[model samples]
Target: MENILEASGLTKRFHGLVAVHDVSVQLRRGEILGLIGPNGAGKTTLVDMVNGTLEPNAGDLVFEGRSVRGLPAYRRAHLGIGRTFQIMKPFPGMSVLENASIGALFGTNGGERSIGRAREQARECLAFVGLGRRIAQRADALGGPDRKRLELARALAMRPRLLLLDEVMAGLNHVEIEEVIEDIKKVRDQGISILVIEHVMKAITSLSDRVFVLHHGEKIVEGSCGEVLRDPRVVEAYLGRRRR
Candidate 1:
């Protein structure tokens, strides 16, 4: 399969600390690549680099066969890259439809130009993420799961070819997670490739075509879900050795 996004030897540093180091990853078109690691393992740092929120200290990011390392976040978004934040903060005093419409107004290919058209797009995206009933509700008034849905809907409104999901299921119950899993599958079915970072093991196991593990700012392993999960390296990283 063709790759929609590629990061080779990507590195990021803040002052004396290296947040990510020589980590490489690829998201194949229509595939969901799960990014997993313990806290401070650089998963979000990697996503930040890919989406242009942070410039890499070294290496390159390629999207659809071209280097986008020099582009700004908005430029990358217009180039078909969309991302959700680990910390969900909806626009204050804005309706859910209006919040999602922001994405439609500033999305891939410059998004929809007309406010009317953007709202229409937003509605479609909202409904797709099971938020149709709450479109008129204030964005900040929605609870945890619904806020997550709003975030997904906003990203979807961008019509992204590649979506970076940063812990979208962080605070959901089993049923809510299952609902999100299905929603994500539907997104993939629509041909959007995904790089999903999650602490939710069940969601990762169910959604990812492959899993990439990071540790101490480096690539520890990358393989099928079962293989990577069972690897000694991943096991040790997530859970300390059993005292024997």
Candidate 2:
């Protein structure tokens, strides 16, 4: 399958601190690639560079066969790159539906030109993320899991071909996490590729087609879920030294 997104020799620096160093990865069409690592691994920085929220000091980023190195965030979104932040940033005062409508209004292909059309698309996205019933509620009214759903809904409303999800399951309980896992499957079924950065080992192992491990701002391993999970380096880096 063709790659939907590619990053080569990607590097980022902030005030002499190298946050990401010579990292490279690819996301294939219709695939879920999980990025896992301990805190301060530069996973979020890599995502930001790919999604155009940050500029890389070196390397190239290609999406859909074109270079997106200098594109602004909104331009990237218009090109079918959508992402949810680790910290969910819903418009607190807006209703759930209204927040999603913003995505439909400014997303791919210049988004919807009419409020009615945007609202219709937003409603469908909300329904897809199991938030249809909460459309009339204020976004701030939702608890943790539902807030994550609202974030997902907002991104899906953009009609992206590639979605970058950052720790969407961060604070959910077991049952809620399972529901999110299912919802992600549904999203993938709709022909969208996903690159997820997660700390939850169980969820990442279960959902990822392949896993990439990062340590100290560099990629240490990339392989099938089983292979990556069992890697000694990965285990040591994140799971700590093994017991005898």
Candidate 3:
């Protein structure tokens, strides 16, 4: 299959500390690629680079066969790349439907020109993520899991061809996690390639067709879930160095 997103020799440095170092990864068209690493492993940093929040010191980012290293976040969103943040922050003082409508207003291909059409798209996304009932409620009034769903709904409203999800299952329980897994599968079914950064091993194993392991800001391994999980490097990275 063809690659939808490709990162080549990406590196990010802050002040003097290197957050990500020479990392290269790819997301295949219509596939879910899991990115797993411990805290401070430069996972979010990498995503930030991809989404245009930050620029790499030495690398190139190719999206849909074009170099998008110079594009801004909103420009990327308009170019069919949408993302959800790790910290779910819905638009303050806005209704659930209004919050999601922001995505459609500035989404793929420069978004819907009409507010009415945008809200219509938002409603469909909200319903898709089980937030249809809360459309009229204040975004800030939502609880934890609901906030997560709202985030997903907002992203889905963008109608992206590639979705970058940052730890959407972080605070959920098993059942909630399972629900998100199914939702993500449905997104993939819609032909959206996804790059997921998650700590939950079960969610990663269940959702990803292939897992990419990162350690100390570098690629440790990338393979099938079973193969990567059983690798000694991955075990040590998650746990600790095993004593002989």
Candidate 4:
């Protein structure tokens, strides 16, 4: 299968500290790739570079057979890359539909030019993420899980070919996590490739076509979920020693 996204020798540094070191990854079209690691493991940093939130000091990023090394975040978005922050960012004062409309208004290929069109797209995205009932609510008024849905909806509103989700399942209870997992699968089923950063083991394991494990700013393993999870190095890096 052809890779939708590919990074080679990706490295990022901040003030002499290497936040991400020599990382390489390939994400195939229509596949969900789970990125798992401990906190401070540079998972977010790596995604930031790929999404154009941060410039890599060294590496090559290719999307859909084109190099995107010097592209700005907005340019990348225009090329169909959309991402959600680990920290949810909503237009707090705006209605849920309006907040999502921003994504529709400024996303891929310059998004929808008409406000009415954007709003229509926003409503559909909200419904897709199971947020349709809350469309009239203020974005800031949403509870935790709903806020996560808003984030997903907003990203979907961008009409992206590739979606980068950062920690979207954090703070959800088991049932809510399962709902979000289903929603993610639905999103992927629509032919959007996904790169998910998640600490929720069950959700990631079940959802990812493949998993990449990172530790201390480096990738330790990449393989099918069962293989990666059972790797002793991965267990030590994140899951710790098995309990007797």
Q: Tens digits of per-residue lDDT for model 1 on 1-244?
A: 8999889999999999999999888889999999999999998999999989999999999999999988999999999999998888999799999999999999999889999999999999999888999999999999988999999999999999999999999889989999999999999998999999999999999999999999999999999999999999999999977789
**On residues 37-153, what C-alpha lDDT tens digit does candidate 4 reach at each position?**
999999999989998999999999999999999999999998999999888878888999999999999899989999999999999999988898999999999998898889989
Q: Candidate 3 on 1-244: residue-level lDDT in tens?
A: 9999999999999999999999999999999999999999999999999989898999999999999998999999999999998888898799999999999998899998999999999999999888889999999999999999999999999999999999999888999998899999999998999999999988898899999988989999999999999999999998999789
RMSD, every candidate, angstroms: 0.9, 1.4, 0.9, 1.8
Q: What is the TM-score of each candidate against the true structure?
A: 0.98, 0.96, 0.98, 0.96
* Candidate 2 structure quality by residue, lDDT tens digits, 1-244: 9999999999999998999999999999999999999999999999999989999999999999999999999999999999998988789999999999999987898888999999999999899878989999999999988999888888889999999999999998898788888888988998999999888877898789999988999999999999998889998998788789
Q: How far is candidate 1 from the true structure (C-alpha RMSD, Å)?
A: 0.9
**Could you tell me the lDDT of residue 90 within candidate 2?**
88
Which candidate, 3 or 4, would have the higher TM-score against the true structure?
A: 3
Which 10 consecutive residues of model 3 have the lowest summed lDDT?
Answer: 83-92
Q: Candidate 2 — what's its lDDT?
A: 0.92
Q: What is the lDDT of every predicted structure here?
A: 0.94, 0.92, 0.93, 0.93
Local error of candidate 2 at residue 90 (angstroms): 1.2
lDDT at 195, model 2: 96
Report the poorest 10 consecutive residues by lDDT, candidate 1: 234-243
Q: Model 4 segments beyond 4 Å from truth?
A: 239-244
**Model 4, global lDDT:** 0.93
